[model samples]
Target: MNEKLKAYRAAILHSLADPSEVGIEQSYQYFEDGVLLVEDGRVVKVGAAEDLLPTLKGVEVVEYRDALITPGFIDTHIHYPQTGMIASYGEQLLDWLNTYTFPTERQFADKAHASDVANIFLKELLRNGTTTALVFGTVHKQSVDAFFEAAQALNLRMIAGKVLMDRNAPDYLTDTAESGYADSKELIERWHGKGRLHYAVTPRFAPTSTPEQLTLAGKLLAEYPDLYMHTHLSENRKEIEWVRELFPERSGYLDVYDHYRLLGARSVFAHGVHLCDHECQRLGETGSAIAFCPTSNLFLGSGLFDLDKLERHGVRVGLGTDVGAGTSFSQLQSLNEAYKVLQLQGKKLDPFKSLYLATLGGARALYLDDKIGNFAQGKDADFVVLDYRATPLMTYRLQQANTLEEKLFALMTLGDDRAVKETFATGQSVHRRG
Candidate 1:
């Protein structure tokens, strides 16, 4: 009976547990006809519409007859500065970075240019039903500043950091150990824990950063206990060899970061495509997470991620578009690529598990599950409304689905940005499809 409450009626589904840990039947909850109630940007309740509708006296419900509502998608790793260069042609990881990524990121040295891309990048996320992301900016401090400004204006829960790269790259994009540390500290003080924004100490990777820079990056983590440490790991074969050459004293690629004291509960490493069993075990033991970027792996010709092996080692895994190399902003597309990635290795990615990785799994990886993932009471009301009939093909395909699992499988296989009918952040509509 609360007048301030807002209600929406739709078919709702959300992940409650990882299907890899729990059986598929016990992993998620679904309501054929559900009602989500919100007040002051928080979920008040979510239940079957028939049960909740009868209890309300005067609350108006916004109903979507042919749509599904689910927790907002989360992208665990993305480069905000590379939004313009997605799908840049035919080079593997190292060459691609030098050819496209570094040059494109250099443009962010201009605050105005960074601000302009931030606006477009965020809107693209909303359009694709992604409400939260762990983003990477250029070495330039202004890139992080501009990215945070746009995120704050939208009231989005976002984590970003300035790239810390000191050596083995173009001089134009490099930052000294002292300068990188100082700039990152300034950004953390200005933006970390400011509303829904958080800071990450970002080292490009083991090869780009010297031991001095890596040590200082770890020091930042010690200085701010709640901050995140984000970086790339074992994504490509050449990159792994490069790490070995750079840090021969270390045991392996992960040991370089480990030697610098970088692995922890808040650390998130992107593209663990080439990780060994020991590396996976260490990641789990330290509570570190990995971003499984399927599209980027495929596009860059990086090896397929052994998701089954990672799960066996008890490591937390999440979905990352890894755009521009990732090729699409849609989590559905990421899920689609994920399915194929698993298929190549003779493993299966069930539809429930796919949804979990994109939503709750990503949140857990980013250590924000308690605040933003799923439709739990008291969590932020960030969710997406997806239309089954978004396109002629989708409408036709969904009509053939016999069960919720079948419907979800079809959506992940065929859906894209067009399937996102509307996106809501904090219970307020932020994007509506034309």
Candidate 2:
């Protein structure tokens, strides 16, 4: 194909294949001194730097010395409107939603506000080295429009939607059931595959949406099963009690979503911190994903996620910085806190698994695995370069690191936006050190 194009040499480390692949761990990094060749923003060749360098005698290069390269972090769930609402007090999920989330999201009805937040939202993600995210917009169509508009301008792979809440929310923030379905359907038709943007059917949760609205949400998902489904699940006990009150005929919390045919490989739930064994079984059976937002869970006093039970169930889990309630947009921070979340439950989340969840696993959970998750040949050229010596403490520890795993563990625990030296999307430099 026209002999390819732009090339760069760096310390390249891509999750070369799915972690389930035979040689994923050892081969996670393709070449220590690696050459990543890109043509028209798509990766064409990946090999040893020394080998590929000689072939391209006069091409421009952006070499990152001693920087660790990995796939750009993929955030499976985040609320763009909640960007400024992070770090608010309290632990109850519902209270936090009503107090901070809904109020801030209400501002999205103003296009200027939506646009401003959308710009800041993307900048925060880029600063933290996340190239792709499944985001939630407010119940306003302008919010979805404003978000997609910003993503389109910035060329980010953003999946978002108009939040659907037909009842139990502030009157100003709610849409009627028919309007919810219609607005979402229109969004699907207009933005589902526009540019790198995709649409998600975002029902706030069972409590806010009536059965009619939830059923329409399932129908919309059925019409575009390829698109992602984003929502909340059993994040708290009181919330489960509220769901039972909302849908008394339901067997359990997750059954509320399942009753409407909203269970599938493409379905993704956020903050499943308190999901029980039966719920996990159904999620596993349907191949749906759970987005672990540890910081948010902790911020709101939600209990520790049962990582052991989830692992045993073979549930597909991904990492998220559920911004606003989540406390930070850094997936590195998500990885850091994810370790603590597991530790509290008497389980350990290995460093590799943490990083993998941020990259490939997150992409898989969103069903974007075939597209932008990892850096194998023929895949989209998305990469993040980390400066190992980004901070004084980290630099000191890197010298004492016994293995790549040790070095990575140090980075995950200590790293933040400072560690991100550069971010690339489709082989284009989206962010770089100042």
Candidate 3:
């Protein structure tokens, strides 16, 4: 018996390529009755159970009936400090930040509060079937310290950074250029490339950061080997106008970050809902990525994102819940809104395409595809088991699904946290439905 090995038998599916690049039929692989083989916290293989079961002489196989297994969902953009204020009432981008976000983030100055919220945040992600996320902390250094401590305790692959807001924010939540740089550099030194955890140099947005702070953020990326740059971009029309007013020398909103040398393969900009064609082309040329936060955009009256335009320009895109303004922690809910966003633009979001955005697309956007996305051999075995019969209505609806695509579409449209039966990270069960 190989005690180090574990296997799960279920209906398994995973994305192999983008449907936009490969045809829909060739974008994914699925097995009606499949076996996922794991050993020592990594994937060994995934294939039909009939072909795999006979080869396993003395390994234990956990069978999940009426469930589908797939790679764990990834959230490319979310604010961990704003977890407490998720669904806060009406206000656009700027007002929302001043009203709900800043006040909520201020509490993170208390290490205990930060730790408490970190616990709740991670649990909620697992409950919603999310295993990896690029997160935001408050301006307080202790906030990131607390978050990393909690994430380390669980051995999860998470990325986060302390916010850098020098101006255009409440005084209580602001940090000077030097202080922000020193704090971020210290955090990068302590957390980046530590176990399964990474660090992101998070400047709140172009409007919040001064040229000096943005330069320092670029410096941090230059100093570190694999550090990430996470920030907001072009979410609201007024926000764009404000950015233009702040940085009059720059051509546009994206140029402000570009002039500071912040564009790169590891950079992720959230809510690029209002970018122009030139901006999209520059992003693609620089190999930068965007976190498509559909729910937040719709909730805040931000404009619809042009996923087709971004794709046509060769940009990489991922799904982001953008919690606090995003209205839901479940990626399924994000996908539901994303479907509507694309529909409004007269574009179709194929079920396979939606699946890719939530999983492999997110991994590629984060530049961690080799480690966390899909069931590729030697990749971390992070996955979720989804119960098709999570509710009576869902069960009834799925029974009428005539094809796999229809079934997947129904799951995204009608599902929420309830659809997540279990979630695993590194081959270990981290969440199980009661």
lDDT of 3 by residue, 198-242 (tens): 999999999999999999989888888578999999999999999
Q: TM-score for all predictions?
A: 0.99, 0.95, 0.99
When 1 and 2 are scored with TM-score, the better candidate is 1
Candidate 3 C-alpha error for residue 391, in Å:
0.3
In the range 185-213, model 2's lDDT, one tens digit per residue, is 88888888998999889999889998899
Better-scoring candidate (lDDT), 1 or 2: 1
Candidate 2, 97: how far from true, in Å?
Answer: 2.0
What TM-score number comes out for model 2? 0.95
Model 3 lDDT vs. the true structure? 0.94
RMSD of each: 0.8, 2.0, 0.7
The model with the greater TM-score, 2 or 3, is 3
Off by over 4 Å in 2: 1-4, 17-27
Q: Can you give the lDDT of residue 414 in candidate 1?
A: 95
Worst 10 residues of 1 by lDDT: 53-62
- Per-residue lDDT of candidate 1, residues 1-434 (tens digit): 56789999999999998987789999999999999999899999999998999877788799998899999999999999999999899698999999999989989999999999999999999999999999999999999999999999999999999999999999999999999999999999999999999999999999999999999999999999999999999999999999889898999999999989999998999999998899999999999999999999999999999998888888889899999999999999999999999999898999999999999999999889998879999999999999999999999999999999999999999999999999999998999998
